[model samples]
Target: MFWTGPLVTALILQFISLGGGQNNDPDVLLESSFPPAEPSLMNLNAICLHGSGRARYPASFFPPSGYAYARRAGKAVNRLEAWFSQCCYEEGAKGHGQILCCAKQAWEAALSHFCTEEFSTMTMAHECCQQRGEDRWNCFAKQAPNPSYQSLPGYLAPEVPPDRIVFTWDPYTC
Candidate 1:
């Protein structure tokens, strides 16, 4: 009987710890304690740095939220940003329209590939967003499968001469 008492107490303690001890209600535990951070130009610039003669787009071109709704979303966004920074440098005023179009297409493609299928609903995204600080972003980042980037045909054709091709962007899709 004495041994049973200790075992039961230990089990109860374990359960309480797992449940966060202070609150057993899951809803309460997941509730957002603060409002979401507003997206800033500085934050966007930090992610998409301008250098190496690459064409630089304004912060408005990037997503407003820092938290990626899916695993692939994070990678795709990062890749798109990097591509713009590296490949679009020589483009000048006349190329701004093309650059904007490409950025929009890439953003749409990334969001469509992952966000549309699973994290489409605001409720699902909210679940991760409610998590505090970096935990929230980390939680969302893990929600989808990571996709590998592949160069599209004609863009980086091995048969084509090296001097002829100046730049390439990998194709990403669902």
Candidate 2:
């Protein structure tokens, strides 16, 4: 279990590297490599779950701007994976600023994935209708598909070791 984190991260980085130097920009190459699904499931936040079944952060806190970005640029799959890896890592870290920085980068990268016109249209299509801002975003993320386990032909899913995948959010947080 202890070794799974590095292993999974290595596997994903390896997979991403296999594309060669087709495009210098990792973001562009990633977008082109994995096209968006119809209606798009990329807007979901990838939260890390501890063994005790507690979430590292409030599940509904972050924005789905990442998903919106991926969809518009036609790179939903890879972008989603990036967010998942980052958030999952944050779960094991202790610094608040670092975690927030990662989350911010995740959102910004997704937002800047493509042109403005594309971003606006895609975002509007998926805008949270009933729930207010954060609530709506949370619902979207919660309902969004988990890309970590998303079935893709010819692609191996990450092996989440039981113990490593589960842990108390903070053993000392009374």
Clashing pairs in 2: 42-67, 43-67, 50-167, 51-166, 51-167
**Count of clashes, each model:** 2, 5
Model 2 over residues 1-174: C-alpha lDDT tens digits?
A: 111343444453454445332223333323222322112223222233321211111112123334344334333333433454554474554454444445444433443343333535634533433455456445444443322333323334333222212222332321
* lDDT of residue 81 for candidate 2: 39
Number of the top-ranking candidate, with lDDT as the measure: 2
Candidate 1 overall Cα lDDT vs. reference?
0.32
TM-score of 2: 0.30
TM-score of each: 0.28, 0.30
> Cα lDDT of model 2 overall?
0.35
